[model samples]
Target chain A: MKIFNYFGNYFSNRETFQEIIVIPVFATLLAIFLGLLLLIVSGSSNEIALKALIALFYGSFGSISSISETLTAATPLIFAALGIAVGFKAGLFNIGAEGQIILGGMAAVIIGFSFQLPFFIHLILILLVGALFGALYAFISGWLKATTGAHEVITTIMLNLIAYRLLDFFLRIPSIQKEGRNDPISKSILDTAELPRILYFLDPNLRVHMGFLIAIFAVLIVYWLIFYTTIGYEFRAVGKNLEASRYSGISPSMTIILAMSIAGLLAGLAGASQIAGVLGRATPGFSAGIGFDAIAVALLGRAHPIGVLFAGILFGALIAGGRQMQVSADVSLDLITVIQALIIIFIAAPVLIRKLFPWIFR
Target chain B: MYFKKFLKISSGAFAGVLLMTINSANAFTACQVTDVGGVDDKSFNQTAWKGVQDAVAKHGIDSKLLESKSETDYEPHLNSMVNAGCDVIIAVGFLMGEATKNAAEANKDSKFTIIDFAYDPTVPNILGQVFATDQAAFLAGYVSAGVSKTGIVGTFGGINIPPVTGFMDGFAWGVKHYNKVKGKNVQVLGWDPDAKEGLFTNNFDSTDDGKAFAQNLYDEGADIVMPVAGPVGLGSASLADELGSDKLKIIGVDGDWTQTDPARKSVYLTSVLKKMDVTVLSVIESVKSGSYSGGVTVGTLENGGVGIAPYHDLSSEVSSELASEVEALRKGIISGSIVMNK
Candidate 1:
C-alpha cells in the first residue's frame, strides 16, 4: 500500500510525468506510423509490411529467450545512454564515447586476461580499471576544453579516430593478439573473468548476465547524483547559465571537468560490461557503433536517467526485432536504422508531432 | 477532416494486419548471413547472394539474407536463422568463421556453409568453401604484363589478409614468370611477395584512399594496376578510365568488373575471378539434393572453381599468340608443372 501511494504521488505530479513519459511514447508511435508509410512508398506489399512489424514485436518479447535477447542488446546501450545523459546535464557533448568505449573495453580485456584473482575481486578490479581508463580518456578532452577552450565536439571526434588506430596497432602486438592468428583478433578473457550468465540453468543460450543489473544500479546512482547531490546542482547550474553559475561561486571549469569525467566513467563501464558479460574477446570493430547510437538514445530519452533507460530498451527492441523481421517477413535490417532515425527526428522536432496530432497536446 | 483522414489510415493499417496473418509455407528455406559489408557490397557477399538467388530459381528453395552491420550481429543473425527453421545457412566472409562454427556445433542437424574460411577439427554439419584464387590471379598477372606498353604494373590490397594477398602474390609471380619467359624486365610495384609487405588502404571501405594509392601507382609509370580491395578497386577503375585506356589498365578482382560494373568495361584488362557464385550455388544444390556433406571444398583452377574472366573489350588489344601463351600458362599452373609460391 505504501509503494502504491508512492507511485500514485509520482503519477499525480502530471507535468513532470508527462514530460518524462508521454512525449516519448507519442513520438515512438508517430515514428512507427511514418515507418509504415516508408514501407508502402518503397513498394512493400501491405501484408509484408504488417508481417514485418509483427515479427519485429514478436522477436523482441515473444518468449523468454526473445526477452533475454532484448535485455542483452539493451544492456550496453543503457550504460552508454546514461553516460551521454550525464554530459547533457552539464551542457557538454561528449561525442568521444565511441573511442572511450573502445579504450575502456581494451583496458578491461587486458586486465581480464592477465590476472588470476578470485571471482568477486576479479570482476570488481576489471570494472574499475575499465571505468578508470574511460574516465582518463575523456578527462583529456575535458581538460583541453577547460584550459585551451578547444571545443570538445571537434576534439572528441579526432580522439575517436586516434582510438581506432590505437586499437588496431595494439591488436597487432603478438602478445595482445591471439596466438597463431595473424588477423586482428584478441585472446579470449579467462573464464573466471567472465560475467556469469543469469539464466544458465534454464538455458545457456540466454546471454543476459549481471551487466543488466549493473546498468540498472548505474541508473539509480546517476539519478541520485543528478537530483539529490550538490555537484549535480552545480552541473545543472553551469548548464543552464554559465555566467550566473560563475556569479554564484560555482567554478564552471571544475563542473565541466567533473561532468565529463563522470560521463566517461559511465561509458567505460558500458564497454567493460559488454566485454566481461557478453563478448569474451574484443575484435577489430567490437564497439560496433553502439557509442554513436547512444547519442540518439540520450536525445530520445530526453537526457534524463529514467528516460535514457527506457529509450535504451526501445532501441534494443528495435535491434533484436530487426533480425526477426528479416527472417520472417524478408524485410531488410536497414529498415530498423531508418525507423530509429525517424524516431529521433520526430522526437527532436516535437512541433511536427504536435502539428500532426494536435489533440495530444490538448 | 483530420478525424476522417486518421480513420482512413487506421482502416488501411487494419486491413494490412489482417492480410499479414495468412503466410504460405515453403518446403525448404536457405538463408545467408553476410559480413559487415552487407549484401550490396559488389564483392564476395554480393556474388554469394547471387548463388542463393540461383538456388531460388533452380531448386525453388526459399531464400533470405540477414546483413550484419557489425561483428556483434553475427551470432544473433545465425541464431535467428536457426530458430526460424532455415534448412541451410550460408555464412559469408572469414569474420564469421568463429560464429558460424559455434552455431554449427550447437545445432548439429542444421547444415551450414562458410565462405573464405575454414575451421580446424571440422564440425560435421559445416562445409568450408575456400578458393585458391592465386592461380587465376597469376593468369591475370601474366596477361596484364602482356598488354602493358609501359612495361610496368602495380597492385595494392585493402589489407594484408591472406585472401587479398593471394591475388597479389599470384600477380607478382605471374609478372616474374612473364619476365623469366620473355627475358624482359616488367617491374611489379606496390608488393614484394618475399617481404609480404605492400601498399594497403588499411581498410576495405575507403574509395578516396584507393584513388590516392592508384593515382600514386599510375604516377610511377605503371600503366596496369590490380587492386584487391573490393569496391575500393572501383576507384582505381574509375581513375584508369579518367586517364584513358591508352594511359592505364585495371585488373579487377572477385567478379568480372565488366559484368559487375559494365559502365567501366573499357578500363578492365581482366578480372581474377574467385567464382564465389558458382561455389555457393553448388553448395545449395547439394543441400537440395540431399548430397550435402561436411568437409572442405577447395575451389581451385583445375576444377573451374577459379579462373580469369574473359578479357571483354580488351580482347581486340591482345594478340592471339599472347592470349594462347596465357592459356598455356594457366594449364601449366593447373597441372602442377608450374608451382605457385603458396
Candidate 2:
C-alpha cells in the first residue's frame, strides 16, 4: 500500500516489472507448491499430477505455437485487467467488466452480422460499436451512483445479471442469431470479422490475433491517459479525495462518469477482441469471469499499468498451462482454480502474504 | 522458496507415476466428459456416465469420468484422457460436437466415440453416435398428449440447439399429430423458438432453474411438460411431482426415468427413451475391435434408438386400450404413416 504515494500521475517511476512479473512468478510457484502439499495430504499420489503438469508445460510453451495460445488467453485478460485497474485507480470498483464484455460482444456480433462491409471496415465497426455499447452500459451504474447515491458494487452486480440476460436476448435477433433457428448464440462472424491468426504461415491454429494488438494499445493508452493527461489529474484527485476535488472545482460526478465510461470502453473492447480476435462469435457466459479475475490482476499488479500487463501475462500462462497440466499430470483443472483463489487471497491480504514470507516482504 | 517450487513439481510427478502404474493393470479403459453439467445431472451426462460405468462393470473396463465445468474444460479433459492412454473416449451431448471434432482431429490414432451430433468436416478416427431422439420424443409427447387432463400440454428445453430443439420440435409435432389423428384439440405451449434470447442456463447443471422455469409453465395450466435439459430436467420432474397432483405431469428424456427416479414415479408419466447405454457400449465395443472410424451413427426408432419407456406409476392411467393406442402411434411414426412437422 506504501506504493500508492509513488503511484502518482507519472510514468517511468510509477511502472516496474517487479510487482507484475517477478512477484507473480514467485506467488504462482508458491501457490503450486502449496497445492501439491494439499494433494499429498489428501492421499492422492502427486506423481500422476506431476507428469500431467509437465505435459501441460510442453503443450503450452514447449511447442512453437503453444505460446500463441498463451498469448491468446492473455490478450483478453490484459484488456480486462486494464479496465478494472483503471476502475480501481479512479476509486470506483467496476466489477461489471464481465457484463460489459458480454454487452460489448453482443454489440460487436450485431454489427458483424447485420452489415455487409469491407473486411477492414467490418472489423473496425465491431470494435467501435462494442466499446461504445460498453461505455453506455457502465454509464448506467454511473448514473445511478450520481443520482441516487447507490453503491456501484450492488448496481454493477445487478447490471452484470441484467447484461447476461440482455446478451442472450440480443442473440435472438434474426439476422444476429442463427438463421431459421433459435439458440442462445449468434451465427459465427463473417470471415471478414475473423481476427486473422498472427502466425498463419507457421500453423493456422495458433491463437495470436488482432486482440493482442488492441490489448497492447489499450495498455499504452491507459498508461498515457493516467500519466500525461489533465483528465488523469482530475481522476486521481477525485479518487484520492472526492470532497477536495469538488472543492478544487473538478466535478466529481462528471469525473466518476468519465472514468467508468472509459473503463467500460476498455472492457467492451476486451469482449470485441475475444469475439473478433479469439472466439469469433458471442455466446452466453463468454466473458468467463475475466472481469472478476481482472480485479485480482489489478491487486496483484499493485494497480500499476505495466504491472497489470505482466500480471495478465502470468494469468494467461496459468490458464494456458492449465490444460497442459491436466493432460500431462492428470491433475484436475480444479487445481488451477484452487491455485488462483489462493493467490488472490494472498494478494488481497498482502500483510498475510508478507507474514507467510517474511524475508521476501521485508 | 525456490526449493519448494522444485519439490512441488518433483513430488507431484512422483505421485502421478504411482497412480498410472496402478491403473494400468485394469482390463478395459473407459473415459467420459460430461456435458456442461457433471455426472449427477439426471439427463444425458448422468445417464451417459452411468452407461460407461455399467459398461466398465460388465466389460471389466477401467473407466474414468472427466466432469467438464465449462467449454474451456473440454480440450484439457480430452487431452488428459489421451495422456492417460484411455482407449475409448466418449463425449456426451451435441454441444460437444465442435470440441470433440477438434480434439479427434488432433489425436487421429487415439480412438474416439462421440455421442450426439457429428461435425460436418468429420474426423477420420472418430465414431459419431446420434440417437433417434425424435422418434423417442414423439413417443413421450404422444403419451403426454394422451394423458393430459387439461388438453393443454407444455414442453421447454435448455438450449435451443438442434439436438435439444430437435427433441422439442418432434415433441410438439407428435403432440399435434396425436391431436389431429384422434380428431381432438390438445393445447400445446412449448419453449418459444423465436425468443429474443435462447433459454439456456448454459450450465445445464442447475436443477433449481429448471424447476422454476417448469413451475411457471405448470402455473399457466400446463398439465404435462417435457424438459429437454439433461439433469436440470429433473427439477421439472420434482416440480411436476409436487404440482402434478391433479393437473400436472412431466415427461422425462434421455433415459428411462422410471428406473432413475423410481421414488418419484407418480409424477413422471413416461420418458422419451434414447438407449444411450446401448449407444455408448456399442461405440466402446467398436473401439475394442479397431474399427472405430469417422461416420454418422444414426439411432432411429427402427433400431430402438428411440421409444417411450414403460409406465411405472401410470400403468393404471394408461388402460389396456390406451396402451394399444400408444403402440399404434409408435408404429405409425415408424412406418412413415405419420409425419411430424414442427
Candidate 3:
C-alpha cells in the first residue's frame, strides 16, 4: 500500500509526469509503428508482420509464464540501470558499469562456490562482496577523475577491457574453472547461496527469483537516497552547476567519488543477482552487454529511479518477447534491437516527440 | 454484388490458411537452437541447420530455428521451442551442454540431439552426437605429411577442448604413421599429442590470430597448416592467397573450405569434415520413425559420418600414390588396424 501511495504521488506531478510518462509511451508506439514499416520495406510480408506483433504481445504479457520470464530478464537490468541513473544524476558518464558488473559477479561467484555457510548468511555475503568489488573497480575511474581531473569516460572504457581480460584469466585458474572441463567455464555456485525462485510452488517452470524482490528494494533505497537525502542533493547540485555546489560547501571531488561509488555498488549487486538467481555459473561474456544496455535504460528513464525500473522492464519485455517473435513469425531478433534504438532516439529528442504528438503535450 | 464477391474471396483465403494449418498440425516439427555463433556461421551451426533443411525437403517435416545471441539465451530459447510443441530440438555446439541437459531432463517427452557433447549419465530423451573427427583429421595429416615439401606440417586450435584436440591428436598421429610407413622424417609443429598441449587463439572468430599462427608455422618451415578454429581458418586462407599455394597450403575444419569459398579453392589441400549434416539428418529421421532414444551416436569413417573432403584444386599437387595411401589409411582406421593415436 505504501508503495502504491509512493507511485501515486510520483505520478500526480503533472509537468514532469507528461515529460517522463507520456512522451516515452508515445515514443514506444511510434518506434513499433516504424519497426513494422521497416519489416514491410525489408521484404517481409504483411501477414508475417502481423504475426510478429501478435506473438510479441503474447510472449511478453499474454501469459503468466512469459511475464515471469520478463521479470527474470528485467531483474539484472533494474539493478544496473539504477546505478547508471545515479551516475547520470551526478553529471558523470560512468561507462565502466560493465567492468564493475564483471568484477562484482566474479567476486560473488568465488565466494558463492568456495564457502559453506548457512543459506541466508551466504547469500548476503555474496551480494555484499559483489558490491564491494564493483565499488573498488569503479573507484579507479572516480579517483582518477577527482584527483587528476581525468575524464571518467576514457578511463572507464579502458577499465572495461581490463575487466574482460581479467574474467578470462580468472576462469582459467584450476580452482575457479569447473572440474574436468578444459574449456573456460566456472564452477556452479553452491545452492545455499542461490536466490530462491519466487513462484516455484505455483509452477516449476516460472523462473522469476528473489533477486527481483531485492531489485525493487534497491529501487526504494535508491529513490530515498536520490530524492530525500543530502548526498543526493549535493549530487544534483554539482550536476546542475559544479562551481556553485563547490562554493556552497559541497566539495565537488568528494561528491563525484561518492556518487560513482554508490553507482558501482548498485551495478555490483546487479551482477551478484544475475549469478545468484539466473545463470548458476559464470562464463566468458556472461554479462552479455547488460551494462552497456543500462546506459540506454538510464537515458530513456530520464535518470529517475522509478523511470529506470519501468525502462528496465520494458527492455526485458522486448528480450523475452523477441524470442517468441522469432519462433512464431520467423523474424530475426535484430528487429528488436532496431526498435529499441528507435525508442532511445525519440526519447533523447523530447521536443521532437512533443512536436509529433502535439495533443499529448497540450 | 461487389461486397458479396469481396466476402467470398476473403473467406476463400481464410479457408486456404486453415487447410495449410491443419496440414502442418500433423507434420513433424523439428526445431534448432544454435549457439552464440548463429545459423549462418558456415561451420557447425550452419552445417547442423543444413540437416534440418534437408529433413524439411526429404521428409516434408516442419522446421523452426532460434539463433542465440548470447549464452543467456540458451535456456529460454530451448524452453520456447518446447512450448511451441516441437517434436525434436537440436542444440548446436558444446557450449549448450548444460542448458540442453537441463531442458531434456525437464521435458522428457520431447526428443533432443546435442551436437559435440554427450551427457555423462545420458538423459533418456536426448541423443548426444559425438564425432570421431580425429579419424578424419588423421587422414588429412597423412596426406599433409606425404605431400609436404618442407617435411613439416603445422596445426593450431581455437581452444583446448576435446573436439579441437581430437583433430590435433589425429593429425599428429597420422603424420607419425606416415613416418613409420615410409621411413622418412616428417615433423608435426604446433602440437605435442603426448603432452596434450599446443598453440591456441582462445577464440574462433579472430582471422588475425589465424593469419599470425599460419605465418609463424610457415616461418618455422611448415609447408601446410591446418586451423581447427572456425572462421579463424579464413585468415589462413587469405594468407595462403598472399603467399601463393607453392609456399603454403591450408587444411580447413567443420566444413569443406573449397565448397564454402570456391574462389580460394587452390589454397586448400583437403578439409577434415565432421559430417554434422549427415548425423543431424539421421537424428531427425530417428525421431520421425519413432526410434529416437537417448544415448551417444558416434560419427566415424565407417559410417560416412566423418571423413576428409576431396582435394579440389590441389589434387594434382597431392600425388595419386598419396591419395591412395590416404584411402588405405581411412580403411585401416575404420578396421581398427591403424590406431589414430600413436
Candidate 4:
C-alpha cells in the first residue's frame, strides 16, 4: 500500500495528458503508415487503401450506428482481452482463450435452453455458467502448471486443441444441438433470454447491447481487483518473483490456480456475451480468433485494464469497419489482421516508433 | 529528415503506379467480389468468380474481388456494393442467402444471384442459383465403390443445410446403388440422407475441422472421403497428400479434384462436380441478353449442371471395366434408374 502511493507520487508529474495518449495514438498512425506500405507492395492502390482506411474509421465511429457496432464488437473483445491480460500481468500466458470461450459458450447454451428464469436472472445464470466453465478450463492448465512444472504456454495451447475437439464432440450430443437442424449449433436463445439492446428505444438497426455496458463494468471490476484487493497484490507479487513471493508468505501454488481461474472466468464471459448478447447461440468457431486477438489486444494495451478497454474499442472499430473498407475503397479486409499484427510488433518495439515520431512523445 | 521525406514521396508515387489499370470502356464501372474465403479457394466462390470474369470478357463489364473476413460481414459488404452502384451482385454461400435476399429487396433494381441457395423469388431482382451437389456427389460415391479396396466410404459437409445434405444424400445413395448393382455390400458413414439433420461444421471457414473429420474417416478404414465445403474440401486432400495409400482417397467437389491435386492426383480418385461457373455464366448471359429469370436455377446432373469429375492420375488406376461402370452409373442416375434421396 505504501509502495503504490509513494511510487505513484514519484511518477505523478511524469508527462502531460497529450504525451501519454499521443504516443499510443501516434503508434497506431505509424502502424497504419507501415500497413499502407505493405498494401502498395502487395500491388494494391494507395488511394484505395487510404480510402479504405478512412472508410474503416468513419464507418466504425463516425456515425452513431457505427459507434454502436464498434461497442458491440469491443464488448466481447474487452472481456476476452482483459481475461488474457490478467494472465499476461501474472506472467502466465493463457493461450486457451478460444477453447475457454467455446467451453463457456457451450455452458451458456445449455443454461440458456434449460432455464425459464426472468430476463436478468437468465442473463446472469448464463454468464455465471460460462464464467464457471472458463474458470474450470483454466484451472486444469493451472493445475498442470502448479503440479507438473509444465509451461503454461505449451499446456494452454494443447488445452485449446483439446477444447476444440471437446466442443465439436459435445455439440454433437443430441441434448445440445438445435432440434431438427440437429446441427452443430445449439438452438438460439429465447428473445427474452437474449441480452437486450440499450439502443432499441432509439433504433433497432444499431447493435449496442447491454453487454457492452457489462463489459465496461467488468473492466472497472478487474482494475479494482488488481489495484485495490489484497489477493491482487499477492498475484502481482508472485508474478514479479515467485521465489520472493513464496518467501513473503504468499502461496505460489494457490495464486497460480486462482489467477488462472479468474482469467478463465473472463474468457468465459467473453463467450457468454457472444452467445447471450451477439450470436444468441453456440456455433462452431463462432468465437473465431477473438481469443487469439485478445493476446494482441493485451500486448497493445500494455496489459493494463484501462488500456485494454481502449485497445479493444480500437480493434472493435477495425472489425466494425471491415465491410466499409471493402465497400468504399475496394481494399481487402484481411489487411485489418495484418495491421493488428503490426500493432503488436510496433508496440513491442515502441522505441522504434518513438524514434520515428519524436513529436508524438514530446 | 530530407531523406525520410523523399522516401515517403517515392512510396506515394509507387502507390500511384499500382492504382493503374487499363479501362477499355467508359461505361464499364468496376465491381468487387466479396469472396468468403478467397479467389483461390477452388470451390463455389472461385467458380462463380470465373463466371463473373467470363461475363466481364463477353460484355466488357468492369469488376474486382474482395474476400470476406468473417460471417458478420455478409450484410455490410453487400450493402456497400449496392451503395456503390454495382448493377449486378453475386454472393456465394447459403449463409449469404439471407444477405442477398435482404439486399435484393432493398435494392429492387439491383440484380443479385447467390450460389448454394435455391429459392422462389422473394424479390424479382434476386436469382437464387442453387446446385444439386447431391447429384454429383452420388456419381462420385458410386464410382468410389467401384474402385474401393475397402467397403467403407465417407462424406461430410460445412453444415446440415439443404444444399450440403443433398450432396451427402446423393453420395450415400450412389454407394448403395453401386453395391446393389455389383451384388456386394458397401458401408458409408458421417452423412445420413435419412437422418433429420446431418453432422456438419455449420460454417465453411476452418480447414482444421475438415481435417479432423477426414482423419476420422481414414482412421475408421474408409477407402474414400468426400467433403462438400469449399476450402474444407482441401482438408481431405491434405490427408490424402500426406499418405501414399491408395486405400485412402478423397472425392473432391465443385471443380475436379484431379485437376486441383496433380501431385497426389493418383490418390484423389474423383470428384462430385458442380459447374458453378457454367451456371453463373449462363445467368449473366441471360441477364445481359434480357432473358433473366427471377426464380431458382437448379443444377442437376440430368441438365448437365452437375456430374462426376474425370479421374486424372487415377484414370489408369481405375480399370477400363470400372470406367465403363462409372459411365453406366452416371447414365443410370440421369435416367432415373438410380434415385438419390432427399
TM-score for each model = 0.94, 0.85, 0.92, 0.83
Candidate 4, residues A237-344, lDDT tens digits: the string is: 777778998998999899898889999999999998888887777666667778898888876666678878999998998887765666555666778777887887
List where candidate 1 sits over 4 angstroms from the true fold: A1-15, B1-25
lDDT per residue as tens, model 2, A1-362: 54453344222224444445555666767787677667666766645545555544655575665577678878878887887777777788888888898888888877877788899989898999999988899989888887787988898999999998887677766767776555666787888877787787886656588788778888889988987898887887777778998998999888888888888898898888888886667777577788888877777776667778877877877776776555444466677788888887766544455456667745
Candidate 4 segments exceeding 4 Å error: A1-23, A143-150, A359-362, B1-37, B62-66, B72-89, B96-112, B118-126, B148-161, B186-225, B238-250, B258-269, B282-295, B312-314, B317-332, B335-337
Candidate 1 structure quality by residue, lDDT tens digits, A1-362: 54454333331113266556777888888777678778867988766767777788888887787888898899989998898888888888989899889989999989989889999889998899999988998898889998888998998899999989888888778888888665677888888888888988998878789999999999999989988899998887787778999999999999989998888888898899989998888887889998999999988888888888999999999999888888888889888888898888877666666678778668
In terms of TM-score, how similar is model 2 to the real structure?
Answer: 0.85
lDDT of 2 at B248: 73
Task: List ranges where model 2 is wrong by over 4 Å.
Answer: A1-30, A37-43, A49-66, A113-122, A325-331, B1-34, B51-68, B71-91, B98-113, B118-126, B177-185, B191-203, B241-247, B258-266, B313-316, B335-342
Between the candidate structures 1 and 2, which one is better when assessed by DockQ?
Answer: 1
The residue-level lDDT of candidate 3 at A237 comes to 79
DockQ of 3: 0.38
TM-score, model 1 to reference: 0.94
Best by TM-score: 1
* Cα shift from native, residue B135, model 3 (Å): 0.5
Which digits, one per residue and each the tens of the lDDT, describe model 4 over residues B110-209? Answer: 7788877765535688778778777777778778887788788887788667767777888888888877878999888787677544557656757887
TM-score of the second chain in candidate 4 = 0.88
Candidate 2 accuracy as lDDT = 0.75
User: Regarding TM-score, does 1 or 4 come out ahead?
Assistant: 1
Please compute DockQ, using alpha carbons, for every candidate against the native two-chain complex: 0.50, 0.29, 0.38, 0.29
Off by over 4 Å in 3: A1-15, B1-26, B150-152, B182-186, B206-223
